[model samples]
Target: MSQFSRLFWIEWKKLFADKTIRKVVFLVPIIYLTLFGFLYSEEKVTNIPTVVVDADQSELSRELYRGFDADETFGLIGTVPTEEEALRWIDEGEASIALMIPAGLEQNIKAGRGAEVLTVIDGSNMMISNTAVRAANTVVKTISAGATLKKLEAQGSWGDEGMALYTGIDFRYRVLYNPTFSYLSFMVFGLAGTVLQQVLFLGIALSVAQEKEQGTWQTSVATNSFFAITASKLLPYLLAGTLNMFIGFTLLLKGFGVPYAGSTVDLMVVATAFNLAVLCVGYMISYFFKDQLQSTQIAMMIAVPSFMLSGFTWPFLSMPTAVAAIGKSLPLTYFLDGVREILTKGHGLSAVGHDLLVLAFMSVVSLFVAYLIYTFQKRKTAGTQAESTIG
Candidate 1:
């Protein structure tokens, strides 16, 4: 066997022998996948509570109130005589939206004048605000159209002319990809990629520390080529990362009925290249640091910034130009975009060619730097040993 191969085997064996490393490699990914997967599922956010204050005391107004209650999007939690009571419910967090119909609503509608129904919304929760606003608007439009048609019929003017005027234009809305706008479909894919990155980084960081802690790094560096040593350390992590990706995508994503329209082979290719880059980064970090605790602290610090700048949680287009430019410099940013395009948009290799090339180039560059650092550290250790022998 080659000197590097034997050294690599020794390092690999040492890594396997550590119980903490073994537990971390298995547990971290599973925990992340389970936690994020369930949190982003479609079962969340089914109904929002709302209070209604009906002062009109008219059949038409009562029908409108019933319409809001009947809709599945909202649950009519309470009926109040005064607007003050409804506001109290909102302040207490018992309701997300409050509907107030003034006393003269039916009187104005009967006189052929438009009546206003005031919708009071709590803006404290952004998701609740958006959902309440949309549901309230839909209820208002439907009720108004129905009331108008009824009034026209009572006046003996509900003819084809009235119908034509009432239905001025058909507004068709098309929701692409996820027609139902299921949150699970959108979030699961993102969570899967994120979990993969975290596990891969943590695994590599710990792997390097194992060598340092066991005092094997000095011996391995003296006997093996830096490239060979780095590769040997990286190989197991690459396997672990790839396996984690497959398990997350299959169990969490596909099992939840999220679409997997992308080319599997292409995703694997990109993921493999990305994992190698991450492994090299881990080795480079190890060369600079000596212990597992320091490595973990540095890894976590690096991960938080890398994840934030990756454009997964936040859109790159919405950020300031300078901030966006800096985010684009991160490798995770490109990898995330490529993963999203391939998995969500079903984009081909040609579309993600630029990102793939960038990842490949980064991997090569990082590996070379790690090799050089390892070589330097090795020479330093050897010179110290020679001096000690002379003494």
Candidate 2:
């Protein structure tokens, strides 16, 4: 017990005893969060550029233009006389969408014959296209519905029963968790997980590999029991990683107002489990490579692809079979999936049960592999009988 305590303190001392580890683990993540927080500060996109082509030259066309102007989503650029002029605005990137009212639209509507309104939307950018398309559709749908109801009233059909003949069903949708559909709230949580995984992996990987890089393990820690040294090293990082998780959660929930709908205990458990899995993997990586830079290179390389493959920004199911199989093997992929459900959908432990089990199994399997590598290396080093100048 005393030996364990001494080894633990040595591990802690070694960490603060170096400046680089302190900065990378503590300061870098905070910097990342602060910069990313601003990206989503304004939770929505507004005033999307739109244009109108009013060939009708009548009251109906003018009313349609007003509707587009009134919506916060659409910022009407200018009215043009021809389809060619409106198409030019879209091609030049001046407008995201355009509504064209045909010349005889008002005349056809007045005569109880429906008129076609052409809507041209830029499909290149999904984000802008989604908002612009919805706004345009709303304007068209509202006007058409009002005109149809009026025509029915004029023909002596009235009330909900009469309207049912024209409209089969009134489908009302309720957005439960994210009522406002703020994109910031959606993105912040996903990115928080991504950044956390990268930093923690790097921190733990560097810890083990750096000792060999600086020759400290040969002179100092090599005298210590192998299990004690490994345990002591892992404990410090586990604690630090857990604390970092809470700090990240605070920033996302308290700072950015992203919802935290799951049990606090559940969040902590998952976070700690994820940290252990990564730390175990880090140890395996540290054992495989002889140099600190080499371990970090491998880690960062894996880190780059982890986010894309994690099903956070993209759907895992939609990915190619081989690519998605690679993603499924990663710890972050499962953690991100569970985090999304717990934070956004307010799901409990049962909801994320499969992912939780997979994460725990990953941690156990990695720890076993790391332990085997550690013992095998220790045996081989003893067999080598290599003399160290520092010792």
Candidate 3:
């Protein structure tokens, strides 16, 4: 064979010889396509969680409540006594939108004084926010037209004459958190979080794994306590990732003009917890897979799908059960959700208390597991060395 042809033939043989390469070349794309296909199979967001605050208990108000409840776009969980309670439902993630009917709505309509209805949409994810807004508009317009026609008939106006005289009710909708629906505001922060995850995961996935691959893992951790070994491996990556996050967000705020309504202290606390969770998970992967390339590929596999599964672009509540379960297991999901809440809603750590706790818990659990793996491997190595020495 010619020199170039001989080299090509050898390289082609080597490619199929590696199972990881074969999987990446053929199977990864299929898996990713299947995941995303199933994810968007519903095509559009539906059955958005909604709450109603019907301050007016009259039949007209009930009619309006029924209108919202009956709509397929909205799934009204329950009625709240006040708008404050409805807002609480939104904050706690019980609902994505709130419809408020003020007192005397029916009386005001009958008197021709005009009634006003308010819609409040949680705007952290603009996709869901926009869907909710459009659906809310449809429901209000339908109800208003019906009410207007009824009033016009009472006054002896009908058909085109009544339609000409008809004027719809005043419907005001407020998009909380991100009112403008700036794509940058909605998307960039989450993308940055995903980047941070990939960088940390790849960087640390080689930490102990590289030593093990080089036949030095035992010597490196053998003399050091497990705590010291784990801390030493994680501390550098943690600092680097935290600095990366701070600078990245600073640019997003100053350069992109993405608004931050939340407190800096709350942001720092959540960021720290998120960093710890990611680093610990990466450390665990390094301990689990001693091959540097295998560990790196595994990290990439996780980080690549994390952004799509994080529910940054789509609402988590709308995802399929299996997809959402996988998403909930990842640190990026909680971190991105918390970041959006802080940036758009001006919420404190107390408000996103659940997300904060989950990230913290993940960090603790992953770190403990990594330590256990390291200790087990260490004892195995020592036993092997003792046997060889006695022999």
Candidate 4:
């Protein structure tokens, strides 16, 4: 075998030779994918416990309660006499959603003064809030429409013309992207990134650090320059990590029926840039630490927080300024949102221009950092060798 081929196979074998490394590099990612996949496997959130306070004491309020009970997303737990009690239930963890049919609600509707149903929901858990608010809004709208139509019919207005007269300025809206509104579609991008980042960081961090520990850094230095060694060390991991991310995302979309309506070319471009940035950071950490364990820890430092800060689950605006600024430094904060826009929003390259530019900048910066770190490592290694020779 040629030198390159021999070295490549050696790197490949190094992955499986250690049973602990094998499990961490492969099995941990799979475990996270399947576990999180199953957690959000249900496309829509359901059975969110809810409580209602009926101050109206009218047929309309009672009818509205029945509607909420019949809706699959909500389960009517109990009724309270006051809105304060309803709010207390939410705060006490007894309910996730609450409603108060205000006093004189039916009277106002009957007199054409307009009625409003006050909905108080715990916004702490975003998924539950989304599901509860959506379901509750549907119930309220349905009740209002049905009652309006019935009242108009009594005045000899009926059918399409009556609906048109009463329903002027209709509040119809479109989801724009994520037509199905599947949770899997919402979370798939972040999950795929989570798995990819973990393995890539773990694999690349261990690459040079393990070699240095085993006294093979000299062999690598003898054969190649610092840049060449860094590239060679990362090549096997880059290929495997890229392939693994692609297959994982493919299965996530196909198996779970998540929607993906975007250009494959766009996805490939962003994925490659993100992979490069992450691998470079890992390589920098690898050269910074001669111990594999310390290198792995440093590389993984960003892994847990990246997903949370990536604007995948949480809005970047909601975070503190310093935290948000730090999040922007990570390639994932841009990549996740960019990929999501492409897949869910049906955005073209032009639409995600800012995201692409940020990722490109990160790739360049990380590569430069890795090269500088490698240079420092080389100089330090040389100084240590000379000192030992003189002694």
Clashing pairs for predicted structure model 4, backbone only: none
Q: How large is the C-alpha RMSD of every model relative to the true structure?
A: 15.4, 15.5, 2.3, 13.3
Global fold similarity of model 4 (TM-score):
0.58
In candidate 2 the C-alpha lDDT for residue 163 amounts to: 48
Would you give me the overall lDDT of model 1? 0.70
The residue-by-residue lDDT of candidate 3 on 68-186, one tens digit each, is 88888888888889988999999877898999999988888888787789999988888888888888888888888898888787778887887486455688899887888888888
Give the CA lDDT, 0 to 100, for residue 166 in model 2: 45
User: How are the candidates ranked when ordered by TM-score, highest leading?
Assistant: 3, 4, 1, 2
| Total backbone collisions for each predicted model | 0, 0, 0, 0
Q: How many residue pairs clash in model 3? A: 0
Best by lDDT: 3
Which segments of candidate 4 are over 4 A away from where they belong?
Answer: 1-173, 387-391
TM-score of each: 0.57, 0.56, 0.91, 0.58
Better of 3 and 4 by TM-score: 3
lDDT of each: 0.70, 0.70, 0.85, 0.72
- How do the residues 1-391 of candidate 2 rate in per-residue lDDT, one tens digit apiece? 6999999999999888776666666866775464335433444445667778888888767777887788777778788878899877765557767777878887887775656777776543345555555667787767667666766778887777564744211212222345455777666766777788888778878887888888776443435665687688778998988899999898778887776677767777788888888777777777778778777866775675676667565443235556668778888887876776677656677767888899889878877787787667666665555553335
Put down candidate 1 lDDT per residue, 1-391, tens digits, no spaces: 9999999999888778976575567755675565344434433333568788889889867887788878776778878999889877765546767888878887787776656777776543334555666777787778877777776777788568586745211122222234445567666666666667777777888888888999998888888887687768888888888887777767865677776558878888788877787777766777777888778866765564565456565444334555557667666777776776676556688868888888888788777788788768888989999999999
- Badly placed stretches (over 4 Å) of model 2 are 1-172, 218-226, 386-391
* Candidate 4 C-alpha error for residue 73, in Å: 23
- As for candidate 1, its clashing pairs are none
- lDDT tens digits by residue: candidate 4, 1-391: 8999999999899998976678778876775575345434454667778888889888988888888889988878999998788877875557867877778887778777756787777553456666666778888888878877778878887777674854211222223244345666677678788878888888888877888899988666644686678668778787887788678777877777677778867877778777877887777667677788778766776686678666466544345556667677887877786776677655677767888888777767777887787666667777878898999
lDDT, residue 225, model 1: 81
